[model samples]
Target: MTAVLNAKTVNYYPANAGWTNMWTAFDPVRINTDLAKAAALGADTVRVIVFPQTFGYPTPSATYTARLAQFIGLADTNGLDVKLTLFDWWSNYTDIDNSVIWALSVLHPYVDDPRVITVELKNEISPGDATAMAWARQLIPAIRATLPAMPLTLTVDGTSGAPGLTSLKSQLATTPPDYYDFHFYGPSERSLAEIRRAQAAVAPAPLVIGETGLSTVSTSEGEQGAYLARVYRAAQVAGIGSVAPWTFNDFAAGAIPANSSVSTQPAQYKYGLHRTDGTAKFAATVVNGAWTSATTPNSILNLGFEAPTANSPWRQYLPQAGAAAITTDLPRTGLQSARFTGTTRTGSGLPSLLTSPITPVQAGQSWHAEAFARGAAATGITELALSWFDINGAWISQHTSNRLPTGTTTWTLLTVDAVAPAGAAGVQLHLKSGDNTGTVWFDDVALT
Candidate 1:
């Protein structure tokens, strides 16, 4: 399998009213600037969704093909690998007909462009179950028959576990695609870890953390940086191939359609690497650091294998080596706390906690690894392991648990406060028990 690892792509949405809502590649100056800035940020790829409303619907087939060519021509000139998304009209209000796919078929030449790496069918299809697979089974092969060797990818809203990936796979008679993708919002670690497990349970196609980022209106930029570092580390260790964060720039007035709900939300203006006024956000620096340096100690870990169900709207590049660790400023607002009653499972086709994200504390950086641990019966838990992958891409294990005098429910919060291993860039926090059956509660893990 080929791993596309030249730094994940970033989204660029210009604030100018003219280019918003409509993506006209014919506008040379505007397209050039967007591509130039993306390449400057070490990005080798770019993703854009063609929603029905943005690009005319019930439009003439010939006209649609012409538009698709314009987009392809633009990407080729920009020297970027592209992940082109088709039929990205999210929400229930809009109506999309089969003509959209027919239009793509008519404009089939663009789908085969060298600059285009994968052609995504949709974005974040909810309840991505059998029905979705049936839809994909009908769609993917049809596209492949025309485009032959081009990779086809599907993106889901959340981790594969949310809607039961196993069942989705059972419904599909064909093997999963080249890669599976998903998104992670918050309780960031928990959501990421779940994605890793889901990948492991599925076959070994490359995995991708297709989308992740802190919401502009609700989270801090600093927290976003911290989460990006953590998530990247986890993804690397998990052997995930690649990751693409939410977007590259601040929102603009005409970025989306006039009636678009996203255009009305505050999050529409934020969730970018740069602020609305052409200013850079702190998270951008952290994301850049992780992307450019492969051996930079404390780098984010990428993780696992597993195919996403068909028709799902998320796709990501899986990390190599093992599972991935994803850190994000996006907070898990209302998700209830989870308590571990028994140890997690491990086996082929079964879930396993294979990777641990490490966040190294630097001299000036105020960072701590805090989590709750408990003991069962009267036996002390030994071999409690916490592994950290340093800047050099080497995995180092650290133990954070001591002997416990157990009996009742005893919770101990272990905090490690230290300077990031001199010149360290990232670290993962892990906890493993020897022979314990007690619940452990972990929350609000942060490094600022």
Candidate 2:
């Protein structure tokens, strides 16, 4: 039997403009630009929200249908598939027949189109609304009758463990979905465990992480990148069918409707991978980097700190009294390695230079890290450390390698064996110098 879903592809949620504004504005140029960006970021599929009222109730207008067709064509040209989510921002349980009309009008033309992967009946009907659930039970079968070959599903509002899922589960007994989809907005460790439980709970039906992300207000740009990398890695490791993050670009101040649900919340506008000015965020690098690694095994970018490009992934962190720089002298394996030379000690913490975040391994998974280092008349200890972070980019724990004695003229190898803790989501290789006078050269780092 053919598989019901494609587990190998990574999908994304693209909101070039805020949800309340995208459909009404319907600017083809903006939509195409966002779709192109999504494709560049390794997204094979994008989830789009279509409002019922805007499309015309009872039956959609011919102009709206043509607009949708144009949008789909644009997405296809960009090498991206579309998951059209119907009946967003609408709540009229008594008008179930109108919803069916809307679905048929929009989906009938795309029934045989390979670019249309799936259809979500409703955005997120409240679990407590028995009336809405009843309407859904009636509408799902009706839509299925009209488009029998199309894959169908519904999105639950909350996390896997939330009460809404319990209600959704009960409703699914009568109105079954081809895939069990849900939203998540929390730390990566919690999301990982929750996804597993959700998969078990909705057995047989494929599970997809429909929406997840961190807003800039709650985290820094670097942390946003780190968080996305961590959660995305967890989903890949767990074998999830797909993952669609919140958005593609931060909505400009005037893009949202004044009365819309997210209008008052500034954080919602900052969830985009790119700023409103069209500048790419650090998270974009993290996502694109993860995609490259997945397609090419053991393909670590900038492995030897050799990239001279601006916004290079490698970053250095030091206390008030420490300093670090990339040097070409005394190379370990490449033309250059990182060099640290400082005498003043802050006694705050271990001063070190760190690498770009790596996709995290599972808990209890054995991993090894290796680096070569040499100290020049140093009076302090030099060591290598591996640090772990949760999905929110919060530090979990760290493990340091055996310290190399100062004043070692010849290059020496430093290695550490570690197992990821229960909630680890991302890892960083660190070359640290103790609080004292020393000059350390580090290079040829590898982790596996």
For each candidate in the order shown, give its overall lDDT on alpha carbons: 0.52, 0.71
How well does model 2 score by local distance difference test?
0.71
- The regions of model 1 sitting more than 4 angstroms off are 1-7, 16-20, 24-28, 56-67, 90-103, 128-132, 159-167, 295-448
- Please write out the lDDT profile of model 2 over residues 1-448, one tens digit for every residue: 0222542133332344466466666788877887787788787777777887778877887878888898889989998777888888889888877777777888999878888888888887776788888888898889888778778888777543445665686876887877767677765434565666667667776777777777886556655665666567667767874666677777777677777867799898888778888888877777676655543122233557675533334555654657667789878876888787874556556677765334545578787888888888876768888888765577899988988786756788899999988887556777787565768888887778
lDDT of 2 at 395: 87
Could you report the Cα RMSD, in angstroms, for every candidate shown? Answer: 14.1, 5.0
Question: Which candidate's lDDT is highest?
Answer: 2
State the lDDT at 55 in candidate 2: 80
On TM-score, the candidate that comes out on top is 2
Clashes of each: 73, 0
Model 1 deviation from the true structure expressed as Cα RMSD, one decimal place: 14.1
